[model samples]
Target: MRSLSLSNLLRHHKHTAFGHDDSHLPRQVIEVAIDDSEDTHELPARKRRGRAQSTAGTIKGVIRRASLSLKGMVHVHRRPSVTAEPSDLNQQLPNGRPTSAHHTWNRLRHAAPFRRSRSVYGLNGTEDGLYEQQQLDHQMPIPAMGDEPPYIPMNTGAAAKASVALQNEYYNRQAMHTQWLQSASEDSNDRESGIGIVVTEPFMESGVSDDGSMLGQDSNISRIDFIKELPSELAIHVLAYLDAAALAKASVVSRHWNEVVRNQHIWRESCLREMTTTYATSEPVQPGAGLGIPEIAPSKNWRQIYRAKAELAQKWKEGKACPMYLNGHTDSIYCLQFDEYKIVSGSRDKTIRIWDMQTLECRLVIGPPEVVNAPNVLEDAEGNPTHYVNLSDSYKAAPSKPQVASFAEHHKASILCLQYDDEIMVTGSSDSTCIVYDVRNGYRPIRRLTHHTAAVLDLAFDDKHIVTCSKDISICVWDRATGALLRQLRGHTGPVNAVQMRGNTIVSCSGDFRVKLWNIDTGRNIREFVGHTKGLACSQFSEDGRYVASAGNDKVIRIWDANTGECVREMRAHDNLVRSLHIDSVSGRLISGSYDTDIKVWDMETGRQLLYFPRWHASWVLSAKSDYRRIVSTGQDPKILIMDFGADVENIEMLKSANTGIGGIRL
Candidate 1:
């Protein structure tokens, strides 16, 4: 009987295999036989007419068990056949069929739950309501395992309300999930697009924690403080973009930034950069054969090369004022004079220094004598006081000394003024005397005029006339040939400080604040140009004799039309008082020296300052004079400076030769 049952099972399994290949048939058949044996005794019996029900039930049970076993085996073995070569599974579906893998997955997901609850809910008949009911079901709590519950249809009453609520919640959850996915996609898109927008989103989201309060509060504070603490260098970088006026104001905001902007090099570089950019496109540089080609044939002397370089440098600095450095004095220079041959400077150092005009080098320095009476003290054989007699006789018999004496130690006071004619030089001093010296000889004093009660401040000369002004408010006119006082002009209420002679008109400036024009022959004031507001320090007539320029303690230099007495032009000449004035006849250039230690030249025609020679003295620039080609300035620095407006080439060459190779001497 068992054999029959097994054979029957084999037959049923074979029939269920359908079109499966027989290569795996033995394994399937063995599995089915084992399954049938395990359940053989427990199977229900089959019933037959008039047979005992127990036996019949047993038979039926055995048949049913065998049948189920055969079915399970067939299902396992009935896989579609695979050929040795891969199958061409690229077959087309029927027209109008959903074709993609994605479509298939979606359709399967929707159909799974619908198929499960179709009968219990009658969902198959109501297609539209089926989706709504499914949505409701998703919201309900899940049932425990193995509990098969009936589908509950959504309705229009309380169940409808519950259903609507459930539908809303389900949709809301779906929308939230969808939104989250969309945001994540957008964030990824932003990152990939390099927009930089979404990069900070994580930080923004994290800024507020789960409790909705800011995280890392102290860190945020610190970050804010850090931003506020940006360095001044950064501030300056920002300010650099501002306009010049605005930038200038910003420099005052802080000391550090002020220092940066004040640097001249920065401004210079900025100017260069701006100029380069501004002209770069419009201006094309002319091509050069080489850096510098000699227009003249090259010479063997390197001096030629140096000379060319210096010439180029001078041309570059043309129209610009240059500094003149002078050194060759031992005491304050009291007088300065220059001619074609040499520059002569007299100093209280009791020396007269002579500088070669062409070479601009000191040629000689004449110092004071050790003794003034050595020649006269010589003995005549007997050793008696040979020339000694009465005081008047001794004075007359004494050998004459050098008139142009350097009474450096002998004089108790400073020399105030110096004047020279062809053969004689007369020096006025604070010692109340005018000493006349024969300059052609060894500086022997020809005579001494001692009538002045106070220091002699100024001296002037004509062919046979000698005029001197003194602090005694007096002017003494002396006969130059006889060394005798010719006349005295004494109307000035204060010290007569300066004297000038133009033909017969003797012009004098005084501390009395007036320029008194006098007729030298009559020794009487013809007219007084009296508009000056301060003590007159200097006065000079124009070369044309039409105007007189006077300057004083008021710091203004006024030019008066000498004939009309009309103020022509008033120049605010210096920061300090004007100490001296000299007009160059050839150039019509007015030179003024000031207590500010500056020598300024002005064009008389335009009344414009032409050149400013600054710091010409460490103290007051006491005097300045110009002869068109050169300017000579004397100051309290005890030095005389000779400035050449011509032949700077030679000067530059000399300077270069002195500075270079070998002995390291500078001319």
Candidate 2:
């Protein structure tokens, strides 16, 4: 009887272990227990049934051992369903314990035979375990109860093949990248074209687009993108070597390229390299000039500066400008100095006038000490007035202010030349004297230097000394503060027309048809630049002191190496005498003003004429000066024509009509 009872109990337990219905459980829990990975596993039905039977036996043994030998045996029981809802059944517990179905499912899931199959995959002839893992990796997660199961991929066979292809592709890509890095490391020039690696993938192929833009939709990845990926400093260093034209072209490559190209320091370097000769490093800041204007700032962005100057230069070359006539002087304008704000012009009328740049009104008139009207107006050999005639103005305008100060007692003759820095101004006169005025202290004459026997023709000064060249065929270097002559240089046989002093060097051009470089302190002629057949009217040392540019009565402009005294380039600039010359060191532009009334701009490097302003002045252009922004020229005409290269005047027809002689513009 005992044996029969044990046998019956064992049989009941065996049926309960594998035969109990799990249909009432929630769908999600059922799917988790036997996910699609299990379904896709291609095991024969007999094999699956055998494994299930073995799992049930193992659970039965575990339960029997627990009931007989363990101190606390755990048993699961289920309560009667409340609404026949599978979700409700999942939530409920029998006798306040885990459900029997959950316990049985877990026991069957972790059975020794089932675990062994999963642990060792594809070693034998079956695709059950390995296939399950690959499918699970790509499978959709199971849905909760009341939700339909998503389309779970059961492509175990296909996934296995794809896994092998993916491994092969990854290894091949790695090898290609390694080779590229090795080659790039060996030769740095290879990296300039950007790093390239040919990655061949079975799913992707390379192709081109219609617009020439890189269209890397699937394959054919562009290596140019790697340049954008470089660190900004390194990328800028690489691009710094490109000239302005190349850099401008590169800016249009892409949005990222444009953004990188606008970096401030990059343009700053280029500006310093190309425009160093023209832009002043130590110009003083003027009042009312720097109100949020970048050009007047202490450390302005070089890109903005370069663009403004380039545009102005283009306009100057084009001759697209309207004339502004400043009418105040009663005689020919002899010498002038100007900046952006004001034009200070001296005339043979025995007066100096300071004109406002914007309004064209004479701000202040500086006459001689006592107003003396000549009994007879001087006449030329042809009976025409030797002095200039005032340009006819239909509209009459008054001076803005009366003469600020008159020094008729100090200067007996016309003011020939003048220059001023921040603290002082020096003026040379036909009275054979030079006057140093204290600009910081009410513009009063501080020193009256008298030594020259003939009229002072031109003068140059620094803080320490004043250099004066005269019709007496001599040059005088004087101590500016003491009004004492320091050294007298007697070299030119004819009157010296122009002189420029830079540091210890003084360069003078004379009517003797010679240009000389001298040491101002020692009174020694450093070198003589001799090539012109006619008298040299103007000369200037370049900003770097490497070259000297001079123009003369011969109507030719010559550039000489200051060190070698070699005539490097010569160009016939004007039909008449070339009276004045200015070297725009920042732009490498040589500006020549001529008695022919033409103001021409030339390329200093090639001696090629860049622009020809025919009849820029109504009469002989006596003196001209320029800053980066504008050019102010004075002539035998009473009006001081301010040719504002900065002006935005556009006239294509005027530019075409201006070319008269000199083979047109070189570029």
Candidate 3:
């Protein structure tokens, strides 16, 4: 009965294990009694029924265990486990409980079945054991209701194949990344090497790159643009290193760069800067005038009459070509002439000044008298001195403070031209009259030839004739000996402005835009050159008499063949009117002066502009003449400028001193 009761109790507990409620009290008591009794054996009939039922339950549990084991085996076959050392899987229990041999043996037993199944299915035994051990470890904590199933291992074919494939993919990716890195490193190394070679080469010989070029090369290396991009102040400092000739060339590079290099203050600073160095060692100790003949006169000693001229020349060189300052004239200078002993200047100040040519000092200023005398019988209202008159009261006179030359007051208007022959001087006035003065005698006019209805613009004289052109469209040939009118050649329809003589032929230019060639003997117009588009200013025949150069307001300087009267060459010579033209007979060079204040030298044969003096004058260069090695230019600045083009420096220095004034020296 106890055995039967034991079997009944076990069966009841089995059903109750899965139920939520417990209703069998007898079954519980029977279970307690069987547990307390020793040797509690069952009877045949009850034992048989109990054994059948227990067998059925055990079989059902075994089938369930097999199914779970099969599932674990399949799972393990798909994915292999990684083996870890005992140290790697270490786990601390609560209260730091130490692992015992008994615990290890039990754990091994729990994983034994999985290990066996793994071996049969061609799976890794060690990996299967690890996986199964982990499963048993989790299940061990739960109380066993009937029987707990053991872990089973799986096959390893799928997991091993998957791992090999993954390893191959990883190796391929790594190889590709390494190749990319290597290529990039090579490219960087190549670039660095190229740059090093380029930087080490000399600028002139190197073919690597140029900053000035506009091609694919880097702009930082371009020579010209790099220079241009420099800061203006820095650029000015660089330009300061250049000499005058170099600076002048730099000014033509570009407009912005030109402004930086051509600044007047910069030029002045450079002049002063250079002077500081030169003055310390090379200051002129002796007067330059005493070194040679005075520039004004080849035959005179400038030292006696003009010691100041030597001092001024030294000062001019030290000052580095600064313009000379003159203070006598109140208006623009219109005419300048140098004689053997004096430098005469005429101005709109209504005065003519004679400066000591040797001394470069103003010696005399002659104008109309302060007072003039009326003719007898000319009376005032008071009639006090009707028969007598004060001659000084009839004209203007110069101041008495400075010693001045005696001059006749005759012209009622500005004097345009002056011609001197020894003691006789002839002056053409804007008043349409020519006055002949006996300069050796008292201030007296020998004759007044009134032939033109308009101003006499120019006058020329030879040994026999005095030829004059007037605004009245007439050319008057006169006897220079007696101031008598010889003949009048009248063909121009406009103002006849300039006259030139070539042997017996008198060539005249006019506002009629024509050049007329006339026979002085017959007073007949022989031929006319009629290609000028503007009024002619001046004309001159070449020294060989083969060509005639004519300049005018048209800004064109035309050279015409003398016999054919056909234009041989035309030069756009000036920005404004060509005021004067002079040819160097010995050098075959042509020098032109213009209202643009510029003087240009040209090679007549090639028609090429040789040199340009852009700012030689502050106003119109009204006249220019060159005598082989020296050029003299006069402008509205009331000063004559002398330029020497000779090999003898001593002679030039002497000439500079002799021709002294508030003007320029040629040397």
Residue 510, candidate 1: how far off, in angstroms? 1.1
Q: Which ten residues in a row have the lowest lDDT in candidate 2?
A: 114-123
Tens-digit lDDT string for candidate 1 (1-667): 4444545534533443233233564554455454544333334344232333443567444444444444333222111223412232222334333333334333323331211221111211121111111212343321211112322343446444443443343334344333222233331232212222121332322232222233322333533322125675564454445544444543543345556555443333332222222111123211121112222222223233334434643543343433344454546887666655455666666455555554555544444454223332223345533222122212322221112234432334556677664477677777788777665654456788879999888888878788899999999999988899989998999999999887788889999899988989999888888778889889887755677899989899988877877888888999988988997643467899999998888867667887777875789987788752457788888656656554444433222211111111122
Tens-digit per-residue lDDT, 285-372, candidate 3? 2222322232232344422323333343453333222222233454566666554345556665555655543344454555555312
After the best TM-score superposition of candidate 1, give how far the Cα of residue 469 lies from its true spot, in angstroms: 0.5
Question: Which candidate leads the pack in lDDT?
Answer: 2
lDDT of 2 at 10: 33
What's every prediction's RMSD, in angstroms? 32.5, 20.7, 32.4
Candidate 1, residue 341: how far the Cα is off, in Å: 1.6
lDDT agreement of model 2 with the native: 0.60
TM-score between model 3 and native? 0.45
Q: What is the C-alpha lDDT of each candidate?
A: 0.55, 0.60, 0.54
What TM-score does prediction 1 earn?
Answer: 0.44
